[model samples]
Target chain A: MTDQALGKPEADRPAKGPLIYRQAVLTRITHWVWAIALFFMLLSGLQIWNAHPALYVGQQSGFEFDNAILRIGAENTPEGPRGFTTVFGQKFDTTGVLGMSELRGTTNFVGFPGWATIPSFRDLATGRVVHFFFAWILVGALGIWAISSLLNGHLWRDVILKPRDFRELPRDIWDHARLKFHHGRSYSPLQKFAYFGVFFVLFPLIILTGLAMSPTMDAGWPWLIDLFGGRQTARTIHFLVMVLLVLFFVIHIAMVLLAGPINELRSMITGYYRTSPGTDASLPLEGRERGRGRSGGRREIPTPDSSPQGGGEQAGANRQEKSK
Target chain B: MSGLILNRRRLIGLGAASAGSLVLAGCDQFDFLGQRNDPVRDFLERANSLTYAAQRALVGQQALAREFSESEIRQGQRPNGSTDPRQNVAEYRTLEANGFAGYKLRITGLVETPKEYSLAELQNMPSRTQITRHDCVEGWSCIAKWTGVPLGRLLDEAKVKPGAKFIVYHCYDVMGGGLSKPEPYYESSDLIDAYHPQTIAAYGLNGGALPVENGAPIRIRIERALGYKQPKYVHTIEVADGFSQYGLGQGGYWEDHGYDWYGGI
Candidate 1:
């Protein structure tokens, strides 16, 4: 709302949109909780991975088995002991990182350096303890979020991709590829797809594979081993899922920065968002030709359960309905 | 415009790298949470029992670990954690040298009848052969054939007392036991794992005698737990009401060193 923050000319100031509350209180709270919990889970997870620096694709793996798909270790060469990482039989020098790195004052050979782990030391016991505790926190938070989202119809309205959403997919993808973004009240097709994939696909896959690696779970759910092929294979999938989640996280943050960081941050933090100005609140149909209607301010994001007229959230919904 | 775009891309890449390194370095400052005596860790670690209880509910007591066929026994089990125990090497060698004729596994503590069995007696008793996966806490697994008497048979013969809640396995290995002290390596199991059909006192692996590298002569296997929970080079099994008298009173060697006592996960 400040002209200085916009850094635009007097002509552009006329297009500055009103700030409407687009995120709910629950959304803001859960978002921060997940941020903290994920930070702990990711680091502690790496700590556990450091214990066994190799990944195999079958039920059993050891000196006698040759099915390792990834292995990180240090080997002695004519030059000296050098750190190397092998993936699918091809090896790469990963010195000063991955296989070997300096910790504190001394360089030592380790799957991942001390700093990457929870304890900042090579202690599997501590790493597992840390990993499991935070794991519970994540599972619990996700459970609460899912139930709350379902009850409030947030799952259906925002996250679930409707048939119309598919029609916008190509356009959304093209806009994203070119660094263009649409500032709207509801989530765009891309955001819906990303959030849906994260919540419904990636998160469940990771948790399921993690449980499959447990001997007790395997005993109780005998079919779990068959589902993933084997315990070792489950572990491999668990590792792969972690990598994908990291990829998602990196892209997510990059998009936030590329899009409008302050506006985005304020929405998630205070439930307020600035829709790009076009249609006036009093004259919504004036900008209908632009296919983007604007409105005054609303205090909360629209839940499909709540349908009040004239509110910004309702205005966005009505505009979307007409477009469809 | 092209040059500016390239510069922006390079800037983003550098930003990501520095942010990553900063996070890695920050973990060192947060190591206090990992400190053994820290209250924060102790509070967080209380979740271990919750997980144990949850998994116990999910996996009932009688559920059996998946058994593999003889053909699935692909390799010799990986030897880990006290492959060569620090203590009782001479005594262990004497037992091995004489074909283990002199070896006697002692069953004592809260049992109604304390008993000692020679290697021959254990072999002669009822036996179970299982080709099961050996899962390590470090996250690798190996499959091999294990032939030995079920541990429950020996516990029944000894007659565990009503109050006895766990069985502590004292091994010949001294893990991190100081040079002057030489504390033996040990692990304990509750009755649920104790009576599981696949929980056996393995004396043979891959259809051959158990190799010294893999707890030769005898090692008890609790099939539903990780490798560390299965202590190797065992010489005694003590029935106990609680872990108060064991190494640091935490149930197992690794448990005392900050591992969760429940190994089901």
Candidate 2:
């Protein structure tokens, strides 16, 4: 090959990395399809969750109202300590109700009064409509993706970690911490762990929880409620899982920003990954150091300016220091 | 010309592909974030009438949700929401004590007949039994076999006036001694649902006395609606022109709160 073709660098021109193809068109499409489907599911799920909004540590039922006072006409006025009630010649404690009532007073539902809100309120009927319609769409897309990925060997090459992948995990973790790696290659173990968890655990949990909410389905599939520890619990878990999925999406977007934007963007968009020569398959060994690997800091950030051998210097230094 | 056209084609192809992917990516965002009614929302609002018309057109007014065998009945079916109804419990208990011999359900409002009948008289007229689920808005459910005369029969007997368009059930539960904004438990449904074959004025559960907590004497079971619309301890069934100008002017008591007026869930 000509010198210019092998690794081009000219005056006023940036050095070029090796051409690498990682994801196939199908993989890219399916990955993005899953992402979009998840977005709809999360937002609609949030609106439904807002109806029975959850509360944090000290909040009371996630609602607010004033403490109700009872005037018993002097014969049974609340006496003794704070938040105590007296009823018909006997005194009783009402500390719990008082605190809950006070909390309820301040943090009520947003917008107009409760009376005018019923017809206009966002009803479950609407939520259920969106939920079921999109649910079928998601299922159809997922089915097509699963079949396509299996027919291709993309599942094997991309998802299943190879023996070498396992062996290099610790080094990869160190490399990732120092931001020394590049894209257009396999994902690290931590990423695989999260991806697998989302696919196997979280997605399935949401699907099952959605099924458990149906009354007609419940008649035929009562066991779904038992499996999810009852209907309300399933609803709560569905909401919690949705929050986790949204958090995952936020973190994923942040990572895309931190990594070299153009390089990362090209890989996701075009199914072709352009990597620096050091991280490229042509010079793979140059990217990893021997004994100093775990201690030698490395990261997965892509090289800027399209340099082919960008990370070689730091990698070489780590190798020599470990060998000595 | 060929080379230039080929370059342009490739550019267009790539742009089309990118735009397609971007559209697909943003599709779900548009779906979730936007507040728009779906086909099912339309379907739910119209399902009662459609189901009614379909039954009339096809099954000749005899269609119903399938009934199950005796052994299929569940055990310990919870009372669901508003279980221990707070209004007129003493009145209900007094009837329950006497096995409801003195109990009568009065049918009035926008009806030509406006007749009140004893529980035995209502039970004797063309009964139907179906086991269906009570889906609560609070996210609990229970299956119970209900046997009663279709509300249509009672309404027909009462001869609902022409202008009458809805049936409002006055139930026996006042919430938090009127603290709950939607106090005085009650529910209502359109004429389409009020006449559905499955809709019944149920007086028995699991083939025994209607327990006090479970709306003794009678209750309206609008099966497709949520549990709160079931309207336990149904004292009177009134056909009205519209829910506005009724109690609190928002249909049923629960509907006055955040619950949907047509809770066909």
Predicted model with the maximum TM-score: 1
What is the Å distance of residue B1 in model 2 from its true position? 17
Predictions in order: lDDT: 0.79, 0.57
Judged by DockQ cut-offs, is candidate 2 incorrect, acceptable, medium or high?
incorrect
In model 2, which runs have C-alpha deviations exceeding 4 angstroms? A1-17, A54-125, A161-167, A276-324, B1-118, B121-134, B138-201, B204-217, B220-265
Task: State the lDDT at A103 in candidate 1.
Answer: 90
**Cα lDDT for residue B28, model 2?**
34
Model 1 C-alpha lDDT per residue in residues A209-259, reported as the tens digit of each score: 899899889999998899989998999999888888888889999998998
List TM-scores for all candidates, in order. 0.87, 0.52
For each candidate, give the interface RMSD after superposing the true interface residues on Cα.
Answer: 7.7, 11.6
Winning candidate number (DockQ): 1
What lDDT does model 1 reach?
0.79
Residue-level lDDT of model 2, residues B140-159, one tens digit each, is: 45556888889999999889
> List-wise, what DockQ does each model earn?
0.43, 0.09
